[model samples]
Structures are given as C-alpha cells and as structure tokens.
Target chain A: MNFSSPLTPTPVAIVVGASSGIGEAVARKLAHEGYAVALVARRADRLRALCAELNARPGAAHAVAYPHDVTHFDEIPALFQTILRDLGRLNVMVYASGIMLPSGFSEYNFGKDRATLEVNVLGAMAWLGQAATYFEQAGEGHLVGISSVAGDRGRVSNPAYHTSKAALSTYLESLRNRLTRKGVHVLTVKPGYVDTDLLKAVARPFWVVSPEQAAADIWRAMRRGKQQIYTLSRWGLVMWVVRHMPSFIFRRLRF
Target chain B: MASFPSADRLALLTNFGHSIGSVAYVYRPTHAEQIAELYRSAAGTGFTVGMRGAGRSYGDASLNGGHVALDLQRMNRILDWNPGTGVIRVEPGVTIGQLWAYTLEDGWWPPVVPGTMFPTLGGCLAMNIHGKNNYVAGPIGEHVAQFTALLPTGEEVACSPTQNADLFHSLIGGLGVLGVFTSITLQLKHIYSGNLKGYAWASPNLRQMMDEMESLKADSDYLVGWVDGTWGGSGLGRGQVHRAHYFAPGEDPSPAQSLRVEAQVLPDTFFGLVPKSILWQFMRFFMNTPGAWLTNTAKYVHARTLDHRHHFLQSLVAFNFLLDYVPNWEKSYGRGGLIQYQSFIPRAAAAEAFADLLKLTQRRGLPTYLGVLKRHRPDKFLLSHAVDGFSLAMDFKVTGGNRPALQRLTDDMSRIVLDAGGRFYFAKDSTLTREVVAESLGPDTLARFCAMKARCDPQSLLQTELYRRVFGSI
Candidate 1:
C-alpha cells in the first residue's frame, strides 16, 4: 500500500512529436528526470536545440535528437535501436506526435482527415507495437499516449481530431487491458484545450490551459499510477455533464 | 552526483529502500517543451512520475521509484523580476534562500519561510509551508500568482487564480500528485528594515498561553512560542512567547545596527559541553519534569538578553540563533529516535483539547519535550492545511516502549482534531490512520482525485508510498 517507493529507472524514453508543444515538454521533462531521452520529431532544428539544452546542463545525464516521422513504420526499429545503442537501454515510449485539422468535419478536406487517422492512429500503433515488443522481451516497460479531451465525446466542429483522439484513447485502454499482467504498461492521457500552437490557432472561449500546467497534470497522473486522468480535473466534470446531457437539450446548444 | 540505472534496469543492478528505490527514472528538463515530451514517453511506457525541487522535504514527499522523477533544479532561472512592483516570475527551482537574498536587499522578504532555507518555490507550493508569520500572512499558496505545469498528456498548461482555477487549487498543496510544476509567478510583500520589533512574554498555563496567542494573532506580524511541557501541577504547560514586527523605515538604525557585535557568542570550540550521559540523565528525570522550570526560565532570560539585530548579521540568521548553536541535537536521543506530532484543532476547542492532550501525555509519562503552538487563518486553496484554529506542534523523544504509547496518544489527539473538523499536516506526518485521513478530509475528495487519475493516467503510471497508503494502487 505504500507508494513511496517507485519501481526503477527506465533506460530510454522515446518521445514522439518532440519538435514542439506538449511533446517537446515531455521530452525535456523525461530527459531531465534521468531517462535517456530519445527525441523523435521532424523538425531537426528544434530537436537539436533541445538536445543542446539538455547537453548543456552542468551534470545532464543523456539525451539526443532523432528525426523520425511517426507515420513511417520502417523507422521504428532503427530509431528504437539507435536509442538502445546510445542510451544503453529502452523502457518508456511516449506517443505525443500529433496534428490537428481544426476546420469543421464537413468543411475539412477528406485527405486531411485520412492523414490525421494515419498519423495519430496508424502511425502511433506502428511505434507502440514495436515498443510493446521491446518491453515484452525485457518483461518490463511503459507506453504513454496523449489524447485530447475533445475525444470524450463527439462535437459538431473538428469531428476528425476528436475521433482520432477518442480512438487513440480506446486503443491505449485496450492495450492496457491486454498488458496489465505482462509487466508492460499502457496509459492514455486526455487533455482539454491546451494553450499550444494548435489550440492557440482555434477560437477557444472558456477551456484553455497552458502547456506547463498541462505538463504538471500529466506528471501527476503518471506519478500516482493512475490508469487515466484529465489534464485539468474540472474537465472530467464537464465531460460528465456533456455525456449525460439530454439529447433534446444537447442538440440545440453549441460547445 | 550519484548516478544510477534507468527505472527498468535499476531492479537488476541495485537494491533500494521502499521509499528510496521508488525513483525509476529522473529527468531534468530545462524547458517546458521537453517536459511535455517526457510525459509523452512516460504515458506510453506506463511509468509513474514525480517531480523533485531541491529534494529538501525531510521525508519521501518528492520521491517515487519505478517511476520517472522530474528534477526542476536546472530550470532555476528568474524569468522576470519586477523590482518596481515586487512581483517575481521564476522557475520552480528557485530556492527560498536565493529569493530572500535577492529581495531582502530591496527591503522585502519572502512572506513565509519554513525552518529550512533550501526548499524551492515549487516544493513550498507543494507542501504549502507555514511559518511563525502564518497568523498574519497566511500560507505561501495565497501569495502565489500563477504556475505552469507539465501534464501526463504532454500538455503545457498555465494555471492561475483566474484561469484553470481548479488546477490552480489542486496544484498548490496537491503534493505533486497533479503534475510537474515548472515556472511560478509570485507576489512579494514590501518590508521596511530587517529590524524586528521584538517582545518576549511568559505564560503560566495553557489557557494563559492561548489567550496571549489569540491576542498575538491580531496584533503581531510574527509570533511563536516555546512551551515547557514537562511542567506539571499549577505550572503545567507553561511557556514563553516571542512576537516580532518590522521596524518602520525611518526609525533609528544605530541600536538595531551593531556591525559584527553579535559574533562574540560564536563558539570557537566545544570547550565546555554537556556530555551525552549527563544529557540522558537529565532527559530521563528532569527533562520533562517540573524541576526543569528553573533551567528553562534562566535559559529564556539569557537568550532574551542577547545583542539585538546587527548590520552584518542578516535577519534570517538573527531570527534563528538558537538553531545555530545546537546542531543535530536530536541525535542525542540515542537510537530510539523521535517523532514530531503536529496537530491543528479549532480555536473553540483549543483550550480544552490542549489541556486534555497534556493530561494524556502526563498520564502516559511520556517526555513532553519541545511544544509549540501557533494561530492560523482559514484559506480556500485546495489541500491547504491552514484553518481558523490553534495548531500545536511537539517533538517527543522516545524511550524503550514509548512508540506505542506515542501512537495511542497521537490517535486520541487525532480524534480530537478530527472531531473539531481539522486535518493533519502531511509534511510532518508519520502517523494518522488512513480512515482518519479519509474522514477528516472527506472521502469524496479522494473519489474526485481518483476519477481525475482514472481519466488522465489510465495506465496507473504514478505511484508513491503515501498514495498507496491513502489511495490504493490503480
């Protein structure tokens, strides 16, 4: 019952979408916390900047930038192997690489929705499956995936992004159920409107949280061994109401 | 400087304690973006996570093994320092000592500071430490303007009183259960000179002390007292109180400013010291006995007559002279160790509760060591322990069979505190039944906490001993 003691250090943490936004923050946090961080992102400049920052620390442990597109399955083995080669071990993999097509589902391009599915769903699965194999072989590992609060339920606008997150959440949940006894961990994180570039581009009114605050929430959920959590706790209540609202009353209002 | 394997490989290589080994991985992100990436990776791996700021918390409040430990020390940078308005924006790693050195020169001091000087602003927010000034300034949370945290969803969010209010409330005293705190903006209070308008008073009984404490709460800016708990009969629970105020700016600085004058008391060597055997004998008999009154009374008079504040000696050093002289004195307790039982009971029941507490201690014949009582104000910050009541903190040195007796006393006292609708402070806790914690701090709060965890960290990535004891494993 005492949670004061945690398991052990992870050899390597492969953070997807380490270019910017929440991905970049998690990468920095993990690397600083003693994980040999593998920064996975497309923007080489930004990743290199982060690597330099981590390396510049007076007694920094280990961190590096790996420019790999999550959408490319062929990059998984090499990207992960490179982490093992450089950091000496691999234990945690985070899927934070994501893109949002903000336009209404009806107005957005069909191709954009497909790309969202491909990058968020298919691409995440490719890397996550590889991570599962790595952890299963070692008999211990953790997999973290980032989802959106929009995934709590369907919305009139941006149905594709919401659907992608909701689907991702379900996939992680199912994966956790399967891996619960295998020493492999799967976590799904759902955040409300984060004050990231993507959310900043939208016309959000009431629910907007800063990236740092969001990171703190993520850190807490992970620390408490919580299977799931909302980045901002109140969003759970908001979702509760949204899920239970009467159809007649709900259909008339716009969130 | 000590290096260990990653969380996964740690079990294979070394043996760590239940509390010490919980750190699976440790990350120190310089920027907020990197923390997001760490969250992303940790979520997929299902590794629990925790944040550490200077790691000054005496116990395991900041440690979580088999999980990632986020170190915010490297991020110690002053993002903004507005000397004009006394508002400072700093990373979570900024230490109280660092902040004090910077602002004290400008005639300002941190509104509150715990006994230790090395704790960080983030740690302060996490524990919500209160000082003697708690009666006047309230807890550290009330002065916080805003904080940015990195969440498990790889989201970087900023929360303040006006924005994301729930998060703001939870993070203040949530014990890092919510997230890794990054940067914080806090409002510093204006101060005059470092001189403290000091007054020393003695109380003959618990009621007299409580009466003086009630008055001190309203009239003084900083107040604290030392109780001679060993006193029994008419002198039982008698003590001395010290109240201090900030000297006005234009007041004469000569009397308050004796440059290097107070250094004369600094001990160059242990020329004459009390031996362990003698101290043990004293503790065994006269330590908490009525005969100790004469010794304590003389000690107070001697301490009161010390040279007042001087130019060279800073306020921080001047305020804690007693601590400087006796270092690690607690080790004198032999191997039996000790436990500090601190409680907060509503002001209405304080007199009777304290009287009952003393009687119980006396009946048990346990050493009624150093007892301190202070006044506190009510606050709205979630997880805040402050209440409009009287808080009593005592350190009991244990002997051979005293542990159980202490536990029983604590349980009885906890019952009184719970009955008065007050809660125990987490930072100074080793006891306090889970049921009591649940009852005192509504079980619904844990439900809400669990539901939030269920939604965000469905993989149960975070785990701490305290969480396991109070909140079951996911």
Candidate 2:
C-alpha cells in the first residue's frame, strides 16, 4: 500500500544478523508491529525461514531476507541500500549481533580474542557507521546496538569479550550524542544472561531470560525513544551495583 | 554444481508438530529461470524435485524425502497493484497474510483464505484453499486472474480462465505435482472499511447447528463456526455459529458490538492480541487432549451466552483470523504439532457424514483438538475440494503413542467421509489413500486430472511425496 497520503513513508527496519537468536526475535516483533523488516544474516535458510514466518502471520507486513555477514564490514552499505530499495524506507537499524568466546587470561586463545574484537567492536562499528549516516540524512530514525552488561565492568576472566562490548557501548553512546540533535535516536541495549545458542558453553544461568523477552524490552525502550536499556529490569539493578562497586573490592571479587 | 550456498548442506524442514525432514538440498530461487534450471538439472540427475512455499502445510506436502526441495519463500514480492481494479500481481512465494496486508490498506482483500494466514498464495493455489464464505466466494482459484508456472520440462506456461484453462484448473489443486508457481495475478475483493459487524449463534445439537447454518448461509457475507466435537450423546457438534459482514462507511455500530482493530495496520482497540513471552513455547506443553477439551468446553460455554446478536464491530483481522490472538498459538499443541483434517461433504449427506466423523473420534476419546465448520459451494477448478456442502475441519494432536491410533482414526473417518458423498481437501489431508482419492474425486474428474498431469509433467518431476502418497494409483 502507498503511504502517499500519510506524512511519513512506510516504516522500515533492518535487523543485522537475524538468522537466529535475539536478532530473529526483534525482526519478528517489529514486523508484527507493521514495520516492513529486512532480515540480514549469514545463513540464508534461517533468514528466509524467519522472513517467511513473519510475512505469513495474519496481520504481518513484508519481510525480506538479505543474506549477509556483518563481519564483512565493507558490504554493510550495500546491504542497507538494498533494504532501502527493496523495502521502500528505513526507520530502524538494529545491530543485535556479536561474537563471544570464553577464556581466562591463562588459557587465552589468540583467534577468539581477535574475532571477538572484530565482530563485537569493529564489525558493530562498521554497520552502525552506515546506519548513523543514513538516519542523519533521513533526519529521523532509530539506531540500536545490543551491547552487554559485561561492558559496564571489565573482567579478568574474559578481557577481550568484556573490552569489545565496552567499546561497542562507548561507540553507541558517541553516536547517540552526535545524532541526538539530528532527531536520530541511538539506543544501547545491554542484556545479562540470555538463553541463546550463541554461548560457547552452558552453565546454570542466573536471571536467565529468553530472546523474545529481551526483544520485547528492547522494542519497548526503542518505542519510547530511550537512550539505553538494561533488559529484564532487574539486570539494570545488577549492572548498577557492578558499576558502583569500589574498584579494589571488585578486583578481588570472583563474580 | 551451480554453487548452491549452504553452511549446512541439508536444509531440514519441520512442521507445527515439530516433525523434521532432511532433503537432498534446499534452494531459495529468486527467479523462474532458476526453477527451470533446477528442473532441468533434476531431470538429468533423476532426482525428483518439490516446490515449497512457507512449508506450513502441516504435513509433508512441501517436503521431498530423499530428493531435492526448492524453497520458494524468499521469492515473495508484490510485483504490481492496481487499487481501483483490485488486481494485484505477486510472486508465487507471496503469502495470503501478506496479500491482505498490502491490499487491506487500499480497502481490498483476497476473496478466499484458509483459517490460518501462514500458508503462501502459491501454497493456497496449490491446495485451492476455501474460506468461511466459500459458499458465496468459491475457492481461491476463482479470484486468481492468471498465474505463471514453471513446468518440470523447463517450460514457463501462463494460464488463466480464458488462456490455458485446462492447466489453470488442474494447477489450482494439483499440489506441487504440476510445477512451481512463479508469478500470480490475483483479483481481490473490495471492502468499504476494515470493520466487520458480526454475531455468534449458539447451537446445542448437530441438527440445530446445521439447520441454523443452512438458514444463515444466504444472509451472511461471511460465515463459519466452532464445533464442540468431543460433546457426546444428543449434544454432539454443539457449538457457536459465527456470522459477519463488512460495515459500510458511516454506518452506526451498536455499543454492544466489540471493536476490533486490524492488527499491525491500525492502533490497538478493545480487541487485540495479548503479548506473550518466549516462555510460552515451553509452557504450551499442557496442550494435551484433556487440556484442549477443558479449554474448548469453556470457550463453547462462554460463546453460548452471547447468542442472538452482540452487534459486535470487529476488525477484519479479529473476524477472519481470530486464531492469531495468541502468537505462535499452534505451539500450544506442543512438540507433537497439530494435525488438521478437514472434510467437505455435499449438503445432502452432511448430517450423517459429520455426525459419524465426530462420533468416531469421540468414541476413541480423542478430542477433535479444534473444530471449525464452514459452508462451501463448488468451483470449476478440476481438483477443487468444496462440493456445494458444508466442510468441517478438526485438529488431532500428534503426541507420543498417538500417531498409530490417529492413523487408524483418520482411516476410519476417511472411509465414512467418502461413503457419505464427502471429499477431502488435500491441503489439510495427510492420510487419504490413492484408492480413496480416486473414489472421492469420481472416475471422470480423476482421469481428466491424470491426463492433464501427463500432458504437463509426463516425467513427473513435479510430483512430491504427498502427491505420490495420496494418488500413487495415477
């Protein structure tokens, strides 16, 4: 349907790394809210499956799967442009994807740390870089990056993972500050433990939340145009204590 | 090798029941040329190919066991739209839900749609789906102005009512046995607004339910019902009769009428889908037959009080697709998934046919998981399911230890339906045999369809597992 009579164009949103996990849920939720979604992910089958499920719902809008790997930083622009061309408009860009590997300083693996930074920091920056420019030019849009609660405080156990998220968090904040005056809202979504296959190993999870719940919280925050969100609400308090704890005491803590 | 992309080579498909199938390959083709190439290659390799759209057919209709399956879901695109003419052209992968989403804003909607909106337009055409108002609107094929199909021989054939009429009719209900539908031009139904004024008439017996349905058929713009199939004795088939029509612009809706907003299109109204968490999937484990029976009974009782006219004004979404109120609602059926069996019986034998169908399940203590009844009338499509009668659809939970019994139950019910001058819808049917299919369709219609199939797909490259399972006699 043409949005000619309406002041705004058709609402479009792009979810990078939507093949599975939280990114898939966010894409589905947004499509349910009448936003035409462009699902970007490396696995074409998963993306296509998710897109098909979204479009098949009784009250759904269009969802097209754009097979892509955000790690391929150079191609992010082409991906966004294709979304604009195929979906007709752009209103939201959610970089809700990253890579994490568990390792202590003693057993630190070279490749894991390299990939962690490449995806969590450099890859996110590359994708958000394109989103920030496009939204600023459009004069209205929402840019979101799913950072982690781990970013609030550095941990000795996984320095690279923590630092990569911290960098993503800082980058998102910088983008928010710069884009705020341009009417483009940038949101940093930080979640604690989410039940996702992305984890390298499973543990008895604490405050374990599902991706759909995380997506819903993020969706609510984005709708309210909130600058940052700590999913599950309780995670906000948990992160607050982690952020406010004395440095010496925190250094000695094994948490 | 044409460089088929696959991090995991086998693209497996699972249904609502969580039943999984691993195929030789899965390809998401962007164009018909890709399908032609695939068919050409399959011919060379002697690998039977099947076309899949959405893969929501509840069974293996879209699955190709030990063969190559083409995933066409990614080909969805609304190619063209003419608001005034209500004629829209879309790729075969375009879904019925998507068709309504695009056209509803322009006050146009597809004339025929199944209960759930998950099935793709191509899938619906392949099944020739009928809706609540089938008695008046006919099957989806009637609303299709034309369609293009990529035959197994690599021929792209365009067919419509006046052009390639034989292929047009056969393809409507040909399953994937004809070929892959490439692009479709559909004629949509026009509506004044998204609002529907409706009411539910409560019935206490099968006789009264069918009687009320017969009387209401001529008056209602749209009609469907929910049957309490597990209710035994004289109260068998007791349920509610749903009737509705699009409210004319500026028409005054009664205060008693509940307002429903077309989901995703309009803002939330008094009637809207409640939010659910990810936990809902795991929580649906309580969806057993007994659990379903309790819910169904409660729903039926609640519906009984709203007899006569509530004068409710509902959004098209709330009326036609009330099933979507609970997101991923089918998951409630739990790990086994929901198996839907819908039977269409000529009005002359509906009373006896539906009674026997329900009684068989009731005797076995299998709750009809979900029972929906809709009035139907015939269309000219060669393999059409509607037959100037009433069609009743019921779901059976395919949980552990129930598959064997369910199979037997389906066999007994199929025999009863066939004997009572009733036909089965291939889309919802998973167990109909080749002999039953020939008997149900009659000799002439079956023979003609086979001849057409031979003419178009002589090598049977387009034939799927479901086609062979249902019509192997051909």
Candidate 3:
C-alpha cells in the first residue's frame, strides 16, 4: 500500500544501537519514510556506513551518525541535545542497544553478567528515561526499546540476559504508566530468533526473521502505538506458550 | 568541508550479478558543496570516485573497486515542484517510482520510466533509459530540463540543452563519468486517468511480432511485447504483444473510479501468503526454461484460442511493475544470478537482427528467458540506448562453468548486433567490449567524451567498475 504522511518539516528518530542489526535497518527504514534519523551506536565505523547508506537514498530525509556507547549513559544527554540542535525536532526514540552472553551456573562470570545489566537495564533507563521525559514535555513522542522473549522465562543458559530483559520490560511498563498521564507513548519490542550478527554461530531456527523484517515489525508496532509486541506471528504464539506455561512444567523443561 | 565515508564504512557492494567490489571509501553528501568536498578529498587520497544510485545496475556500472564510490541516495529531496507546469526538481536518489507515487494522485506521471521503478533518477538520466512509449516520447533524459553536475574540482556546473551544451550532451548518457549528477529537474506528463486500456495479442513468429509491435506503437502510447524463445521451428521467437493506452476519461466508463489508486498491496494468494524467501525460491524454480516455456506457451495458446480480443483496464502499477510483487525474486536465478542483455538495432534491420540473435542463442543452447521487445525513436542523449527502431531484451541465467561460454555467446551476439548496425546499453552491459563501443559510437564520440572528462575531471576522480570495464581508465 502507498504510505502517506503530512508534508511538513520531517520528524526526527534517534535510533540507538544503529551500528548493526535491527537498529541499522530501523535507521534506514525511518529515513526512507521521511524521518530525519540520527544513528547512535558504539562502533563509529558501522554507524558511519549505515548513515552513508541512508543519506544516499533519493527523496529520503537526512541520516546522521552519532557514535556513542550506551554503556556510557552519561553521554546520551549531550547526544540527544546535539541531535535536537541539528535535526530541529524529535519524534521517536528507539533503544535497541543491549548485550547478552551465555553463562551457566558453574561458569558464571560476574563481570559479563554485570556488564549486561549495566548496558541493558541501566543504559535503557538513562536513554529511554530521558526520551520519556522529553516527549512528555513536548506532549507527543514514542519511546521504543528491544526487550526479548527470554524475559518471559528465566532461562538457565543465560539467566543474567533474561533477568536484564525482564527488568527492562518492567522499567518500560512503569515509564509508560507514568508517561501516559502526560503525552508519551512507550513500546517494548520483544523479538524471537531474529537472524542477527549475534546469532550467527547459533543453529538456524525455523522462524528466524531478518533484522530488516524485525525492524519493520518494530516500526509498525511503534506507529500503531502498541504498548508491547512480540515480532513475527509465530514468535507471538511461541512467546505466549512460554509466558503462560505452568511454573512446574517450565522449571523441569530445560530450554 | 565535510569528510567522505571512511574505508571502514565502505564494504563490498553488489547489485544483480556475482561481481562485487569494495570501495575504499563511500560518501553520502547531502549538498552540492559536500559532494564537491568529497571530490577534493578523493584527489588528496589518490583514489578515483564514482556515483552509485540505488545500485540497480545489473552489472558493474555502479560498482567501484579499490576506489571511492559516492552513494548519492542520501542527497534525495524535492528541490522544487511547479504543479501547474508539471516540472519537479528532485535530488538524484529519488526513485522514479517515488516520483510516480507522489504525483499520480495529481493525475501526473513521469513521462518515461524503465520496466522497474527502483532505479534512481540520476541513474536513469545517466543511462538515458527508455520506456515502452520510447518511439514517441524518447528517453528519460529528454524529460530532464537540467541537472547540476558536480565536477571533480569542486565545481557545481549546470548542464542543460542551452547551458554548457558540450558537457550537457556528454553527461546526458555519460555513465556517471565527467561528474556526479547532484540535482535533476524533470518535466512530467499529465494523464486523464490512472488506468491504461490494454490487451495481449499473440504473434506467431519474430517478423509478425515486430509488425504487431509497430502496429501497437502507432495506436497505443505505450507498447511492449513478450517473445517466447523456447520453440525452434516456425514458432521461434513467437510471443504476445501487450499494447496499452492511457485511458482518456471519455472512453473509460468509470474514469473517476481511478482518481485514487487502489490498495497497492496484492491480496495474499495461497502461494504469496508463504514466507518471502520460500516464495522467492519457488518462483525461481518456476521460472526455469522448461517451466517458463510452458507458461509462455500456455499463455500464447490461450490468447490465440479467443476469437475476439479481450481488453482490460489496468492501473499504471499493474502495467509497469508486475514483476515487483515478487521481491528479491531475481535471487532465484540461481546462486550465480543472471545477466540481462538488451540490444538496440535500427528499426530497418530489426527483423533480420532478431533472426541472427535468436539463432546465436538457440545454437549456443543459452535459454533466452523473459524476452521483451519495444519500439523506439532516437534521442540525442549522447549515450542514450534508444534507436530509431525497436530493441529486444532477454535474461540469460548464468552458470559457473557456462560463464566463459556465455561471454563468448554474448560477444558473438554483439558482433551480430553491431553488423546489423545496433549497439548495447551500458546499464545492462557486463560484457561489452571497448572495440564494439568505439565502433558503434565511432572513435570521435569516445574521444570527445574522454576529452570532456579530461577537461572537467583532470584527476579522473569519477570512475566505476563499469567505466573500467567498458572504457579503460585514463
């Protein structure tokens, strides 16, 4: 279907974790749809590439690369200010930056698990929190972040990763509760088996969706102003069973 | 001055074929000054530069190896639009499809667009692409009022019919050489309705098909024929000619019905509802020689069975972008992919040229699937592929072992086309020899083109794998 939007000055979308995977695709996709995109990521090189690719599309709004690590949450305030100063406006904040590492009970590493919490939970809180506040002040804006289906269940393989996502999902819900009173919309995106660079070494799953598709789903959910969504139809079903399963059955089943 | 995209940012890029290249640098400059800055930077780095639109070029035309490639898709914006005159100025990255999408509601359309609407406006002008109505309207370049070409030395020169006339002619079909097209202002056409009145007529042979195409051209504003290449004897190169005319509101009973286009999405057919990659794989196998021939034959036979012609009113999208529904379907052309060869022969020599072209491919056992024929009149866009006659385009699946043999087959076909007084289009050309190019355009044309380049881009900053392949680097 032909997509139509008002022919006013373009809106701005700050896409964090845009250096790779879903964020990269979102930055490009939003730029094509007339959203001036500011790409944020830790890797300057990757963000630069994505920024170049997005900027070169004809009739598309501008895309700029802003390399900033989410782990260094303090820097985001200045980064958002610079984005506002340059792009003139902000309409959406998409936080797809997070880390995950597989650690079993015997081999659990405190540093790796703590790093995941700091990046996924603390980082999301700082960045998305600021976006929530800004958008609430502006009276209209969307705040979207990538949580995971792992949050639905405490997985033994990567408990830290699951806990971080669950924490993130709760933080987003609480933010949404507070922001709804004011004019901000918060969306939590939970993806299952997304074919990203992070999943390259893993066995190919039957329903692994591409980052491009994942980005499209997330953008669609954000546009529809959904509070939360499980990307891809099969994933929604898969997550449903996982989320609703009796704790007695869930604990016994090693996943 | 703004910096160009770094080497780390520029990974190997691919288009249709197996050919891939890693540009040392890739840049997306939003303004003419930024593009000028990129050129200056390339000079200092001792690497040449090339322009890449949507990277729709099937071959290496847009691929730059071991050099800087300027990705211009970001410099896209509607610079100006005069609704009254139908003159719209757009950045190079805007796709022809976008132009149509935005303008069709206003009952206006770009005068010329290639079969697919994905290619950028700048690339279309560079290739001087032709539409089905080429016999009457000429190429896209003719509709272009002017464009700002950023020269290598940070000069943003305006090239049009009346200004910088030499550079204008050379740059028209200059294949992204001379300079980068930063801005383009085009004249659009006005149509009474969004739908086209069309029909598919079955032709028994190559000669009859060309005749049918000519007849269709005379009456219809847009004309294209699909020639089947499977059968060898009397039915050789036999196919269906699909002719169409823009509905003149008066003739169409419900002209106002199409004031707004119907939903662009196709309903989920049983097969379409399947996941995309699986559907793409299915289409690939479904388009193999035997399968495609059967479908084409069935279509031809089915059309011939009818005593009276059946006319259908179709939307512009239904007519032009029928292939777009199957996204990434070309990937199914096998792991190696396929190459599309479109040769333009003078109308007088077309019938004879087609026989030889058919014989060459048939004898080589190269399956010429998806054959398209179109009538055209010549345009003065120096590198324009349109001829004062008609052209036939076909896609040949490329196999690993048959690639060399396929090149030989194409080389032989090139000789036949050149002998019949025809030339190749650079956009689909991955195997065009320099000798044929020089022979077709004459040494004077190439020398003149090179002279313009040398004078404007002294450092030879603008070069792509296409330039290196078709024309040796300076």
**Interface RMSD for each predicted structure:** 11.4, 20.7, 19.4
Q: Write the per-residue lDDT of candidate 1 for residues B182-236, one digit (tens) a residue.
A: 8888898776555556766567777887888887577777777777766767766
Per-candidate Cα lDDT values, in order, are 0.69, 0.77, 0.77
lDDT score, candidate 1, position A118: 82
Candidate whose TM-score is highest: 3
Colliding pairs, model 2: B17-B336, B17-B337, B257-B312
Candidate 3's C-alpha runs over 4 A off are A1-255, B1-5, B17-24, B252-257, B261-278, B306-310
Per-residue C-alpha lDDT of model 3 across residues B370-439, encoded as one tens digit per residue: 7888888877766667778878888887764676677778878899888988977888877776777788
Kept native contacts, as fractions per model, are: 0.00, 0.00, 0.00
DockQ of each: 0.01, 0.01, 0.01
lDDT (tens digit, per residue) of candidate 2 on B403-444: 667777887898999888889887776666777888899999
Candidate 2 lDDT score relative to the true structure: 0.77
Lowest lDDT sum, 10 consecutive residues, model 2 chain B, at: B252-261
| Each model's chain A TM-score | 0.90, 0.94, 0.93
Q: Residue B101 in model 3: shift from native, Å? A: 1.1
- TM-score of chain B in each prediction: 0.80, 0.92, 0.93
